[model samples]
Target chain A: MQGKAVVPATRRRRPSSPDGLVLLLLAVPGIAWFSVFAYGPMAGLVVAFKDFNVRDGIFGSPWNGFANFRYFLTSGDAVTIIVNTLFLNALFLSASLLAGLILALMLNEIRGSLYRRFMQSTIFFPYFVSPIVISIMLQVILSGVGGSGGALNNLLSVIDLPQLSWYTEPGAWPWILTIVKVWQLGGYTSVIFLAAITAISEEVYEAAAIDGASRARMALSITTPLLLPTLGVLLVLGVGRIFFGDFATIYAIVQDNGILFPTTDVIDTYVFRSLRTIGDFGTTAAIGLFQSVVGFFFVTAAVLVQRRFHKESSIL
Target chain B: MSTTGYNESLLDHEAREADKPAARRRARRRPEPFTVASHIVVTLFGLFCLIPLWMIIAGSFTDETVLARQGYSLFPNPFSLAAYELLFSGQSLLNGYVASLFITLVGTILSVSSTASLAWVIARRLPWISRPLTVFAYVPMLFHGGLVPLYLLVTQVLSLSNSWFAVILPILLAPFLVFITVSFFRQLPEEILDAARIDGAGELRIFFQIVLPLSKPILAVLGLFYAVTYWNEWFMALLFVSDPDKYPLQLILQNLIANVTNATSLPGATAAQAAAPVYQLRFAMTVLTVGPILLAYPFAQRFFVKGITLGATKG
Candidate 1:
């Protein structure tokens, strides 16, 4: 009976047909998900082509060809906005990675398991805090109002320095934002790097110890080199996202403060203000398209770089 | 029984550690003492995380007038419930809180269940669909057309603008949640799925009765993740809803903070009262807003630590 069933099964291949259908079925949910949420809105990109008007609506808006794109490129603030975005992202990305790695290293050295667990849990709580909350917290801390009103400003006064208007000051924002980003994200990022660190075989450390290597020396020579692939992947992902910004945080914190626009206005915030405030959908979409395309290209480049360095371990 | 067993093992570990010097003598030399500087460094970093939370709590309790005068102290000065009193005063605040809770609860349940079902199907390696489906699931994570188009799609195209559905539906089919679910399903043994099939069980029956029951760990993780995301979400509310009644707690808190920050003065009061700090109010509101999550997190800390490690470790 088994032999007879086998011969028929070979002829019919029941699993193959239904399994193929199953794969097709699985694709349906994901495809449908992206189509509605990710790709469906892509049609609105056409608003960038037309001189968009609320009266005309998104689709019925009149075509202005490259006029929007031209306007965006020719705008006086374009260079300043683009450069500021790139600069801030570079600062933020590098600072976060460094801070995260340092924290992970510190956590790894912790002697007691309970203490290590406690530290991990406590530090990671901030990662879950909303960006809006962080913005609110920072504003209160930095507002520099005196006679008990100011946090940082009061500290400055005690040291005989003038209180800086943090909200108004563009110069100090880059540093402040970088620090804020690091504080919130470092704990989260450290977990990833820490996992990579722990996944390193204990036998390798044991071997190095037999060779009379110090813990610090072993960490530098053995652990860091081994963890490079993980770090490389992280770095590439960050690089890929350089064109886009964390709009929620930046918009909530910075708002319409024009003085800070030169330092704090990223592509996301710029496009947002352009769309909402100026009612320039076409130009804003053009800028959005520009960021997306550049982001795609850079992300592709980063993946390629990761593949070159780490081969199969690279996410790409 | 298992809890008692765990305690016994922990006690055994203590006993073994107590004999460590005897073992070390046989090994010729003990490892160097842990560096004192490392302890200092770790302690400082731990305090860095703890202090902000303490300040937020301190600020929330501190009298608004005294807070205005004192800058934010770790110690609550002239402690009062003024901020809390004012925060909960408006009907909209109560409505926002209710709306947020309902959305988060409903959204997390629906999102986690659907994602897990799909993940179970994909993880079984049905030989025909897994690879391509996995690729399709990951694409949304990397590329998205900017916010305007997405917003327009949600509001105008889908006609969900100002509707609670606007925030809830779009977030329901999150790609990250699906990916997390898939990673979890992959960790489950194929034999269980095969055994179900051999028992002549249908896919839906097997999933609900068997697959889901065994997936508590991942479910807890993904549920918590999606819950937090839904709770903290305000940008969606800001974009889609104009009605204050429909706003989530985050958005309500955010608007209040924004208003206070921009107010520049408490103009109705006398000069001395006006001079009293207002920035603390924003901090206070933020503290009140995040209070629920902070209170809840300690209980779930173990789950979060494990869940986060699992989520990020693979990706």
Candidate 2:
């Protein structure tokens, strides 16, 4: 009985046919996928250290210790790329969390379920939209030329404000990205918080209602505080990937726009350009290594914090 | 115990959202400032999310010259389907749709099955097997191995360049989804599994006949997630696939928008048909590409809402 989990009844009788080994068949595909795609890349990361040449291949290339890192450092692109990544992500994370919180609070207060669902459904549409489409939407609003201009320029002209080239405006990209981030994720984020708010015991609300507490007071006092743990978890998870950014959205929106790179460029985009346009695998891989190493630190912190909060069910 | 708590929270949410008729029937009290403000805020925010979409829909239907002159509007004063008409007439456009549908359907099935199977093995807590696999899955979440290696392996080593599998294989297993499914599976009654084992039901039989049927909720959640991912995939296509024949709808739309002259004109359109198709055509393409997801997401909303919240609160 004690060893039942290890040795099945049928397996005990058939000594040659081990159920333990057979059970492993289920995991073979996954393990193979992990080995080839996931761990396989880790081994190939050695290309970062070498001066990789097409003729000589990844290994045969001469070893250049830290030169790739040095070039990136001296070129000053490293600091800018890292700063932009952190700054943009920081803005996105804080803004998204705040917007989500507010939206959730508002949705929770709506007395009518049908209206609430309608608003919820409307807002969640962008989350499902492809970034390609989002980029097109951005262009439609931000193209800023007569006849070919989008809505924003028309609105600006209506207000008698000057039309400017939105694509070339580096100063405006951070804000644009933050707004885009919110548009894409605000509903999804709010839905999670709404669920947490929904999960709050009904008795607490009932008690408050009996005590003649207004809806706002209960929301700010009871709901906000109750959502903090969830907020903390999301924050930690977000902070874990601070060194990384969404390559798809950024690349889709700001494809090869050198002028906007001052604000919109991130580690992922930088590495991609270095790979595709420049064909410098060593420098690109070095930057990737930098991102992963720094990212790993925050990940450690996140895991440590999650462990303290939910020891029995650490997500990592 | 934890999973029971997690599941009950989801149930509580459903029960509250759907079963609160009494709240609606309550006597109308005068609205407070907060309540009024909330309505205003929610309405304004909802409009902000919606108006751009409206602009595109209107823009898509408007005449090309009207779109160019008026920019995009919330109203299409002169409606025309020339963009859609021209787009659908192209052979490449049809191929893009077929490719995107095939990839999304096939990718979702492969991804979901592998994810579920891996999760089941992990949930069983099988001593020798599960621990290492867990670490293997988990480490990628913490530290990515960088794109150069991944790209090189996909293109050079695996040689999946120009192949659809290059787009599908890398995204096949997300560790996050695996963990969520594992947690859900672990919550299933062990007594049922034990009962099946005692009745001489093999592991695979039990998995097929029992486990999968019981876990439809998580499967739906994950299936939608994967389907959306595969449908929206263009970056992977950009990276691995170079052939126009294999371009998904997103990739086609991407290429169309990036340079309206390239694939935008399409092969079969006459000079007159190709003329003046940029502004309105993009809006039309945007509508076609995103329309399916918009229509589908609403139906799956409840499941994803439950799925994400469960994953979130449980974390």
Candidate 3:
């Protein structure tokens, strides 16, 4: 029966059948949507060069050549904004990566499944919560005018420590923002690393144990080394995205707080502020274009490096 | 019970072997000091994550005057329901909930269906379309036109501004979800697909009858993901939608916070209204917006873990 089925299956396996057309039809909606939304916007990047006027439209707008790009690059705030975006993202990436790795390692050491599950679920709760909601929560916990007077300040007063004005303080924002980023994302990212760690075969650990290796030694030497590839891929992706500031977190937490703008303002917020406040479509578009171009190159470089080091792990 | 007995016997055998002089060193089974340390660390971290949420919930229940005087507390001093009352009493809050529900439901359905369809097509390895479609899917992941152009396409070209479509359409076919689903579909036993094909089922028929039924777990996982994303979505609405009536729950909450903050700054009659324990109201709003999804999370937690593991390992 199996032999007969195989013969028929071989006969039915035609290459250029009408089923190809059917599959193509199935792909149409997605392809069309991507073209209009993804690639269409990509082509619309040309508007960065053009003077984008509402009356003349994206294409019909008069060409401004490099004026938009030139203006953005030369603007006094450009260097500061770019630096702030990179610095903040780097801080977030390194802090979250370290925290996530440490947490995953600790979680893996846990013996009871139920306790581990509870801990993971609790930690992942914030990842699902909207940043907008977090911003509100942060206000209740940090705002100076609150009844409970931002929780931290209240705690400080109780301890006889001076209360710091978190919202208005520029120098404090980078640390505060990084902590918030880690708080929101650390557990979620740890889950990814934990998944990777769990995928490591139990046989390796058993062998290491038989060799008289302590659990801590085994984890440090065996597990951490094995997790490096996963960590490398994640880190590479993080470095590639160093140019992109988390717009939602920054926007919500430091909305129009000009006093804190020195540390808090990033390329995303700057561009958004420009578009909203100045309505300079060309300059903002240029800024957006700059970010996309640099981001694309970095991502490509990371993929290339991944391919070189771990051929099987290359995302591209 | 049977499994535990078998494991004990296996352990006895291993121990007996370890006792032999010829045998090599055996692994220790006792819990180490590090295990206790690990528990303490994890518990501390867990508390760190849970405390903020606890504080918000407690603060929401605290009376306005008490909250004003004492600050946020782990336990409410003079508990009251006024914050919740204010939230539910307003027509905007109810309207925001309606808008959010409609968007999350409709958006998830549309997104999952389209993603599954595209993924199925790509996963099948159809003669001419598979390779190109795969590359097409990835191009968007690597490079995007950035916000300015995307905003232009949505507002100018598509003219979806201020409409729910603006919120729904741009996110309907996320590249990440599509790729994840594609990898999942690709892992489905090819032999079954071959059998279905030999049974004279067309592509669509096989997909609808056999493939989709086999794909419920992944589809459910993706649906939950999309639903959460849509529920949490406010940024797109901030950019595109200007009408107050069209605001989603997140945007409404954001506006409420912004209005309160803005109102308090100005020296006017509105400042008095803004001074009505806005922190407590904000906390209440936070609970209202995030409560349902957080509640739903535990139920979906198993599938979320499974889906992510599959995607991570395969991708």
Candidate 4:
């Protein structure tokens, strides 16, 4: 038996066989897809190191290493993009977290399972509604009179208040975008937090009750303490993607209206416009590489911090 | 583990029950204040979520000038089917509908299966390759060279520039979908795969005949994600395809709505031109975009919550 098993095990199978190459075959189509569309673009990153004339081509171009980096640092748009992206993301993250947490807590506290389920579904529905749809909806609602359908104007008129022009105005967009983000994600985010809440030991709440605590007190002292781990993990993950923006949201809402640039021009939109419309592949690649490096460093740091904080309990 | 704490809290609340049985019963019977508050809050939010949809549906039924003045009331005013008439009346819209449906159908089927297969193979703890492959897949999410080279590769190298494949291929092998599937397959019982092998079935046979069928719930979830992504994706269509007949629903909607808005504001526009059934068209197309998914969602939605929660928790 041992001799027979050894003979079968040692038999070298043909790697090209349809059966034996399942993994290879399974991977090929996807690998080929990425190789061309995703990874092929890595060649463009070299443009940052070269003068990048269309005539010279990406590989044949003479190198001017670090010049692009230097140029980026000096450019005022760099500061604007960084500051704008960070601030917007920070606001979005905090607002979403707070609202999601409250919603989750409230949902968890409810005894009626049906209502909770219905609410959860409704709230999550917005998340599924594409950003493009949301953009058009917002345009109609926020368009001031003598402008378009201006639903908000109609609502305000009912209360005898003045209508506001939401478009062509940069100041209100950050708030508007933040609210939209919360609306889109609050219910979805709550699901994760609610899962964490459900995992909390009932005995801890019982112990808190034994101390004669009110529901509010129990929530503050016992529940929040247990949820810290989940919250920390979420915060770290959010911070990791601080350098990126929702390209769909930004593109749909802003849509070539350069007036909104100061408030809404994220690194993604800037890079896309530079590459597609202006035909500046080199600069776009340079900016993309810059964004990636910063993102990589920050994500690494965030992961390290998460590991250190919840060494054993952390799911991620 | 935490259930013990819950039991204790109930016990504490139940302390001295005999002395105030009526009060205790009332306390229990009256229901927690949180219950009422939760329902109220949730219902209000549900309405908040539904309002835009309601507005869109209502707007789609009204005249353009009526909508322009009323600004999307919940009740239809001067209700008209002119928008629907104009949309279904046109040959272009009908072609767009057919194109979008075909793309979504074909794309979802191809993308989901390919992604699942790749995900399953990589999900196994086979040799050193699995770990490296996962890392390789994840790298694109972190840093990608931007659009130009990708465009060149698709058009020049792959020679799929104007073909529907340009829109379909790049999105088919999404790392995010693969990551989701790998996470899903990782949770399945390894013993099932072992059992199939022990029964003398080939690996391919086991994967298709055993594993794929068992993974339907996750497959459905990923299928929905892919379908929605395909449906909403007008950017790729815009970049790659110029053929009006090849244009998907979203690209067509984008052109129509943007043009309508522009035309309404054009300096020399007449009231008739401004009110030329454009507002209703905007809402009508919006309805068309969301119609399929919304109809499909109620069936698969129960799976959605569980899938997302599981993926989130596991990650």
lDDT of 4 at A23: 60
Q: Model 1 reproduces what portion of true contacts?
A: 0.36
lDDT for B145 (candidate 2): 79
Query: Interface-residue RMSD per candidate?
Result: 5.7, 4.4, 6.3, 7.0
Q: What are the per-residue Cα lDDT tens digits for candidate 4 across B1-315?
A: 123443344234223222222322333335556556766787787787888887888888887777766567778877788778767756666777787887788899988888888787677645554676787777777667766566655665577856777777777777876887887787666655655554566656767877787777678878888887888787777678788777787777666545645543222234665546666777887887888878877776766776666656565
- Candidate 1 structure quality by residue, lDDT tens digits, A22-94: 4356446556766788777666788778887777789898898999888888988788788988898999899
lDDT of each: 0.70, 0.81, 0.79, 0.71
- Tell me the lDDT of candidate 4: 0.71
Model 3 RMSD vs true structure: 5.8
Which residue runs does candidate 4 get wrong by more than 4 Å? A1-21, A51-57, A60-72, A144-149, A206-212, A309-316, B1-27, B260-275
C-alpha RMSD over true interface residues, model 1: 5.7
TM-score of each: 0.87, 0.94, 0.91, 0.87
Q: After superposition, how far is residue B88 of candidate 4 from its true place, in Å?
A: 0.7
Clash pairs, model 4 backbone: A201-B2, A202-B2, A202-B5, A202-B6, A203-B4, A203-B5, A203-B6, A206-B9
**All models, RMSD in angstroms:** 5.3, 3.6, 5.8, 6.6
DockQ of each: 0.32, 0.51, 0.39, 0.31
For residue B149, model 2's alpha carbon misses the true position, in angstroms, by 0.6
Which pairs, if any, clash in model 1? A23-B129, A148-B69, A148-B70, A148-B71, B68-B277
State which candidate, 3 or 4, has the greater DockQ.
3
